[model samples]
Target: MSDDVRDSLIPYDEIVQDALRAVVGRVLSQIVGYDSLPGEHHFYITFKTQAVGVDIPAHLIAKFPDEMTIVLQNRFWDLKVEQDHFSVGLSFNQTPSILTIPYASITAFVDPSVDFGLQFQVSDDDDTQPEPHDEADNDRPEVISEDGSNVVTVDFGKKR
Candidate 1:
């Protein structure tokens, strides 16, 4: 057998990414009605600051610039989960800020209590560019072909 792998025309990368992002949505949805995270289940969600549909405060954007990680352990409110994005109220420096982050913009999701994590790779062909970081600095990758504390990483870049 040859070592050559074919580039898929089915956009497997996009499909996988979308599906994995949905996992994040589903997990969040579960906590919506209760309005609280269950027993020892806090989250650390990281996302791109400048993605297409992200709505965060200006100061946060300035501070994060490329990426930001928010902890959902406690002291959060207005947890809203939608098909493509999620919004929550969090306090930074004692100042409350609401963040609306699209699933497309999310780079990582971690439930440290369970040692679970997901990382993604985001690309904005025209005016934006994907952040440069380690393969697993919370990149929200879709493909789950790695070993590290239940962390699922999605990377479909073709090898040429």
Candidate 2:
């Protein structure tokens, strides 16, 4: 293979990214449709709190600042998935609340029991750039092991 630069009219990377994100939406839709989860099937969805179409609470935005992880399991309601986003009702120490998250905002999605996961690339609109946002924050691994057990990390990075 030779290293060369070429331009195409279609943006293949963007299209594939969109499709992969849709998988997350479709999976969530199916789980919500079942009305309950089977065995240890659960999701830990991590997303950018400040991204477009994300509708988290002000307090949550302050707390998470950059990103946040949400678990969809025993305590949720009104699960709705849309083209570019999804919304769900959750509780903060018994305080009921609703949140809408765009697929573009998502950074990572994990199912520890099944060892399945997906990590999304940041959108162009994000002003964070390639520079580290925070030294301590960058030092921490992007995906943390769930339940203190080995978890698989899937890399989408590839050469086309």
Candidate 3:
């Protein structure tokens, strides 16, 4: 085999990313259909706050300027799932707010009860650049385990 490499015309990386994001949509749809999370199952969805199509309160954007992780647990309501995005009502400091997040903006999803997780690459939106945030500074509950038991991470490198 030669060391030379060639780029394919198909955008396989983007296709696979879309497919994985659909998994998150399907799972959220099931929860919405049931009207609640099953048993102890819940989700920790981390997304880029500045991503396009993300509609969050100004306060939240101020607090989490780069990225934010929301826990879909006991207090969330109005769980609406769309083909490419989801909207849900949550409270921050006793103030209720509704957030709409596009699937493309999501960087991570996890269900700690089952130790399941999925990590995605940031979408290629030339208009917006994602800012990095330190995980140590985040206040959300830890969802990914260190044992690496059931977590699924998908990484498709840039197409050359």
Candidate 4:
């Protein structure tokens, strides 16, 4: 048999990416509807801090300097989830701050309590671009953690 690849007229990549991003929105909607986290079901969401429509606090921006992870449990208010993004108010060291994050900006979502997670591949055309660094620095990804609860990572390396 001859080995030949066939192409179809379906944009599967874009379709799949849109659907996966919807999962993030749906999950957030469920949480907002319930008005409280179930049991110990908290989320550690990591997203591009510089992406469009992201409204993280100034202090957090200074601390993170890149991306930042936020917890959605115990002390959060004004949770609103839209089609392309979500917004919520969270407190940092007893100070209230409002944050708006687009779903596309999200790179990782994890619920380590159940060993469940989802890592997404960002499109090259997205407005948010990775920071430029030397080859040595590019070899290693930066890890940021707060309280060592649930962890998720977004690596833009080719799969081996």
Candidate 5:
């Protein structure tokens, strides 16, 4: 048998990405009515700042031109999750900002409280152009897994 694998007609990568993004939506949906997070469960959501359908303040766009990670912990409000996107209110440098992000713009999601994480490949054709951005320092502790049990990473780039 040859070592060639046939290209799939079905867009499995897009399908799987959509499904995984749904997981994020579902999780957020469950907590929309809650007053607070249950027992230390919080989320670190990272997304492309310049992705189409993403809306943020001009200051934030200038600071995080390529990507930004937001912590959904204390002091977050107005979290509205829809079929294709989510919007929330967060504070940055003592300034309040409202951000709306499409699920397709998300590149990573992590709940370090449970050592669970998901990483996605940003599509090259998604109209994302990198620009100069201020390097915001993130001090979250890294959760390392030796057994490789609770992390999901998907890469759909075709091999030559």
Candidate 6:
């Protein structure tokens, strides 16, 4: 392997990122089709709160200024998936709210039931990393274990 790397004309990283985001959309779309999560499958989707195309309540944005994670296991409704985003009704602090989240805003998606997860690179629109914030703690979801055998994390750092 050569240490000296050249910049490629094709934006391979962006392409792969888009494809992976599509996976999230496709998965949610399938769930919408069935109108229920199959077996023990569930999802914990984390996204940038202030990202473009994200339509969340003001209180939620205030609580999670940087990022927030939403669980889609139980106690959720009106799940809808679109070409670039998805919306779902969830209760936070006993208040029901509908959040529209763009796939590009998602940083992580995990199905703890199967110990499967995917971490995505942030979009070009945002250059800063998300600051640590308190957990949403909206729904009392089952705890995820420490095992990470099925997690896929792709980082397009500088090539050496």
Judging by lDDT against the true structure, name the best candidate.
3
Clash pairs, candidate 4, are none
lDDT of 2: 0.72
Tens digit per residue, CA lDDT, model 6, 1-160: 4434566878988898899999999989888845457789878898888889999999999989988888887678889999999999888889999999999999888887888888887855546766766667843343444565887776787455
**What's the residue-level lDDT of 135 in candidate 3?**
48
Best by TM-score: 5
Q: For model 3, how does the per-residue alpha-carbon lDDT over 79-116 read when each residue is reduced to its tens digit?
A: 99999999998888888889999999999999888889
- Preferred candidate (lDDT higher): 3 or 5: 3
Give candidate 5 misplaced runs (Cα > 4 Å): 1-5, 126-133, 137-146
Pairs that clash in candidate 5? none
> Candidate 3's error at 81, in angstroms?
0.6
Tens digit of per-residue lDDT, candidate 1, span 24-80: 999998888554578999887888888899999998776667887777766788989
Q: After superposition, how far is residue 102 of candidate 1 from its true place, in Å?
A: 0.1
Better of 1 and 4 by lDDT: 1
Quote model 3's TM-score.
0.84
Q: Residue by residue across 1-160, what tens digits does model 4's lDDT show? A: 3333434367665576677778888988987855457888877677767677788887776666556677776677889999999998877777888899998888777665555566666655554656642222112233334544343333444323
lDDT score for residue 157 of model 6: 72
How does model 3 fare in lDDT? Answer: 0.83
Order of the predicted models by TM-score, top scorer first: 5, 6, 3, 1, 2, 4
Residue 51 shift from truth in candidate 6, angstroms: 0.5
Give the whole-model CA lDDT for all candidates, comma-separated: 0.79, 0.72, 0.83, 0.68, 0.81, 0.82
Error of 3 at 64 (Å): 0.7
Show how many residue pairs clash in every candidate, following the order shown. Answer: 12, 0, 0, 0, 0, 0
TM of each candidate vs. truth:
0.81, 0.75, 0.84, 0.69, 0.86, 0.84
* lDDT tens readout by residue for model 5, 1-160: 4545566678999999899989899988988856467889988888898789999999887878788888887778888999999999887888888899999999888887898888787786655556656666432444435565798887787557
Instruction: Compose the digit string of candidate 2's lDDT tens values, residues 58-145.
Output: 8777767777778876667888888889999888757677999999888787776676777777664544544324322212244455
- TM-score of structure candidate 6: 0.84
